[model samples]
Target: MYRLFAGIEIPREIGEELQAISKKVTGASWRPIENYHITLRFMGEVDRNTAEDLDHELSLIEAKQMQLTLSGAGWFGSSEPTALWASVEADEDLTRLAERCDRAAKRVGLSLDKRKFRPHVTLAYCKGTPLQEAAAFAEKYGFLKLGPFWADRFHLYSSWSGKGPSRYVSEAEYPLT
Candidate 1:
């Protein structure tokens, strides 16, 4: 089975900016620069046939480019936060793209997480991190106000997590006009 997901890659410039602001949080395991992406859907583990089906369905998705902005920083989980993430504003184009991915996955008989799509690029994974400290750090950064980057493509990424930090490899690229 292949562990996979579909997401938009963050530009190098924006990743650098996010990396700069990721420090000073105690007990936080920061994500590597290459791992920064706005996940459209997490497809989890699937067999080769299912992956191929998803690839075919995804490639058929035709949508226009989206003006994406990386904005704000925050942590999920109320007490003892589990992750610190950079928020993404989901405009209509982004929403449509995500929906198309979701529909494709569903059509291919892949079960998806039922959570509402809250777009974010995870900055770090936290272990027993104090809520106040994380909250303070988030408040300090508040709104990130980064570029309105143009997203003309998204990818099918395979993750390898056995090592120190999870490594994401792009298995397929699907472009939008």
Candidate 2:
């Protein structure tokens, strides 16, 4: 089985900007610069046949290239604060692209994600970090604003989760023209 997802890739400059503010929180496993992206769909695990079908379906998606902005900062898990994220703000183009990905997932016989599409690049995965520490980090650097950058393509990516930094390899590229 392969752990898969569909997402938009971040430019190297934007990744470097995110890397700058990734400090000041303990127990928050900061994601590597190369791992940054706005995930469109998260398909946890699937066998080879399903993966192929999903890939083919995703390739058929039609979307126009869009500009996205990394604006503000936030965290999930509220009091527990499970993650720190850099939010993405953009036109309906982003949502429409995500919807195409959703349709692709469903067309391949995968269950559609119930969560509403909220575009953001996860900056770090928190583990046992106190709410105070997380809050302070957000308070200090939450005003981060980066890019109204062009997103020309999305990808079918394979995720590798291990002890060190998470690894995501782009297995297929889908262009938006």
lDDT value for model 2: 0.90
How many clashes show up per model?
Answer: 1, 0
lDDT of each: 0.91, 0.90
Most accurate candidate by TM-score: 1
Q: Candidate 1, 8: how far from true, in Å?
A: 0.1
Q: After superposition, how far is residue 11 of candidate 1 from its true place, in Å?
A: 0.2
- Per-residue CA lDDT of model 1 for 70-133, tens digit only, reads 8888999987899999899769888888899999999999876698888889999999899998
- CA lDDT, candidate 1, residue 96: 88
